[model samples]
Target: MKIARREAWTGRVLLLVLMAATLMPFLSLLVTALHPSGSYPLGLEWPDDPQWGNFATAFTAARMTELLKSSVLIVLGVVPISLVVATMAGFAIGHLRIPGRRFVFLAFALGLTLPFEGIITPLYYLVRDMGVLNTRWAIILPLIGLFMPFSVFWMRAHFVNMPEELSESARIDGAGTWQLFWRVHVPLAAPATSSLAILLFLWTWNQFLLAIVLVDDPLQRTMSGALGAFQGQWGTDIPLLCAGSLLILTPTLTVFLIFQRRFVTALLQGSLKG
Candidate 1:
C-alpha cells in the first residue's frame, strides 16, 4: 500500500510538470503582451504598466473586425456543409451493404493523405475561373472539400463502431435508412459530431496557407491571413503582434475549453472501440 501511494504521488507530480511545460509558451506570451512598451532595464519584467490598449491597437490596425467576420462566414458555410455531406457519406459507407463500398471507403480515406499544396495550382485556376479568387467563398468552398475527408473518415469510424443490432432493431420497427440515420445514429453520434466540429473549426480558423494562396483582398481574408498582413505592416510591434495572435486564438480556445470534456470522452471512446 505504501509503495502504491508513493507511485501515485510521483505520477501526479510528473503530470503537473508536463502540464506546466505545455502551458509555458502561452503564459510567456500573455506576460509579454501585457508588458508595457518601456517598462524594464532592457524592456523585460512583470509589466510595471500593463498595456491593455495593445489589444485595441492590434484590432484596429489589423482590421480584425472584418477579418473576424470573414472567418465566421467561412466557418458557418463550411462546417454545416462538411458535416452534412460527410455524415451522409459516412452513413452510406459504414452502414449500407452496397457494392464497391470498400473501394469508396478507401478512396475517401485517401483524401486524408492528400496535401493542399499538391492541389493548390489546379484549385487556384478553378477558383479563378469561377471568379472567386479574392472572395470569401474561395476559401469556404475549398475548406469544405478539404475538411470532408477527415470528417467522413471520423464519422464512418464512429458509425461502424455502433452495434449492428441498433440498426437491425430500428429496421424491424419499420424505420427506413434515412430515418435510422437521422433519428437514431445521428443523435447517438453527438459526441463524435461535436468533437469533429471543434477540430474543423480549429482547422478552418487557423488556416493560413489556403487563405494566403486563395485570398488577396485584405477585407476578404480570415484572421490568420489578416495576421500575416498585420505582421507585414507592423513587424516590429511585438506587443501588437502578440495581442493579435491572442485575439485570433480566443474563439478556437473558447470552443475547445467549452467542449473539452466531450472531446476527450469521444476521442477516448472512439480509440477504445477502434
Candidate 2:
C-alpha cells in the first residue's frame, strides 16, 4: 500500500510539472499581449492597463478574414482527398492483401522518412512548372502528397489490426469488395477515422513552412503562414505580434478541445489493438 501511494504521488507530481511546462509559454504570450502594443515588457510582467484592443488591431492589420478563407479552402482541398485516398490505399494494402502489398507498403513507409524541408526545393520548382505556384493549390496539393505516407500508415494500422473474422463473415454474406469495405469495415473504423481527421485538420491548419514556401501570396497562405508577413511588418510591435499569434492559434485550440475525447478514445483503441 505504501509503495502504491508513493508511486501515485510521484505520478501526480510529474503530471503537474508537465502541465505547467505546457502552459507556461502560452501564459507568457497572453501576458505579453496584454501589454501596450510596441512596448517590450520584460517576461511575464502584467501591465497596469491591459490593451485588449490589440487583438482587433492585429486582426484588421493582418487581414485575418482573407487568411481564414484561404486556410479553409486549402484544408477543404487537402483533408477530404487525403482521407479518401489514404483510406482506400490502406484498405487495399492492409485488409485485402493485394499482390505487391509488401512493396507498396514499403514505398509508403519510405515516404515517412522523407522530410518536407528536404523536398521543398524540388517541390517548389515542380509547382512553378505546373503554373500553380501562387495559387491555393500550391499549398493544397503538396500537403495532400506530403500527408499521404503518415495518413496511409495510420489508416493501415487500424485496418491491419481489425479482426479477420469480420471480413470472413461479410464475405459469407455475399458482400462485394466495395460493400465489404464501405458497409462492414468503414463503420467500425469510425473512431480511428475521426481521430485521423482531427489530426489532419490540425496539421493542415498549423502548416507554416509549406504554406509560406509554396504560395507567394500572403493572402493565399494559411493563417500561421501569414505570420511571417505579419511579423515582417510588425515584428517590433511585440504585444500586437503576440495578439495576432494568439488569434491564429485559437481555432486549432478550439478544435482540439472539442474533439479531445474522441482523439483520446482513438489513441486508446489503437494502443489496445497493438
Candidate 3:
C-alpha cells in the first residue's frame, strides 16, 4: 500500500509537470497578447492596462470574416471528397479480390511518402495549365489528393480487421457489392470514418503551405495566409499577431473539443473491437 501510494504521488507530480510544460507557451502568448503596444513595459510586472482590443484590430486587419469563409468552404469541399475517395479505395483494397490488389494498395500507400514540396512546383504548372490557379478548387483538389493516402491506409486497416463474416453474410443475403459496401461495410466502419473525418478536417483547416503557394490574391486566401498578410502590415504589433494566431487556432481547437469524446470512443472501438 505504501509503494502504491508513492507511485500515485509520482504519477501526479509527473502529470503536473507535463501540464505546465505544455501550457507555458500558450500562457506566454496570452501574456504577450495582453501587453501594451509600442514596447514591453519596463520591469517584469503584469501590464497595468492589457490591450484586449488587439484582437479586434487583428480581426479587422486580417479580414478574418472573409478568410474564415474561404477556409470553411475549402474544408467543406475537401473533407467529403477525401473521405469518399479514401473510403472507396480502402474498401476495395481490403475486400475486393482483384488481381494485383497488393500492388495497387502499395501504389496508393506510396502517396504517403511523396512530400508536397517535391510536387508543388509541378502541381503549380499543372494547375496553371488547367487554368485553375488562384481558384478555391486549386487548393481543394490538391488537398484531397494529398490527404487521401493516409485516409485510405487507415480505413483499409480498419476494414481488413473487421469480421469477414459480416461481409460474407451480407453477400449471402443477395446484396450486390455496392449495396454491401454502402449499406453494410460503410455503416460498420463508422468509427474509422469518424476518426478519419476529424483528422481530415483538422489537416484541411490548418493547411498553410498549399494555401500560400496556390493562392495569390489575399481575398481568396485562408485564415493562415491572411494572417501572413496581417503580419506584413503590422509586424511590430506582437499582440495583434498573437491575437490573430489565437483566432486562427480557434476552429480546430473547438472542433476537437466538441468531438473529442466521440473521437476517443470511436478510436478505441475501432482499434479494439474491429
- Candidate topping TM-score: 2
Superposed Cα deviation of residue 133, candidate 3 (Å)? 1.1
Which of 1 and 2 is ahead in TM-score? 2
Q: What TM-score does candidate 1 reach?
A: 0.93
* Candidate 3 positional error at 164, Å: 1.7
| Tens-digit per-residue lDDT, 1-274, candidate 1 | 9999999999999999999998877776677788654332233356777889988888888888888889998889888889889888888888775789899889888998999999999999999999988899999999998998899899899888788899999999999988999999999989888889889888998888888888988678778877788888877767777788888888888988898998999999998989
Candidate 2 colliding pairs? none
Q: What is the lDDT of residue 247 in candidate 3?
A: 83
- TM-score of each prediction: 0.93, 0.98, 0.92
Worst-scoring 10-residue span by lDDT in model 2 = 208-217
lDDT of each: 0.85, 0.94, 0.83
Error of 2 at 140 (Å): 0.6
What's the true lDDT of residue 142 in model 3? Answer: 90
Off by over 4 Å in 2: none
Between candidates 2 and 3, the TM-score winner: 2
**Best-to-worst lDDT order:** 2, 1, 3
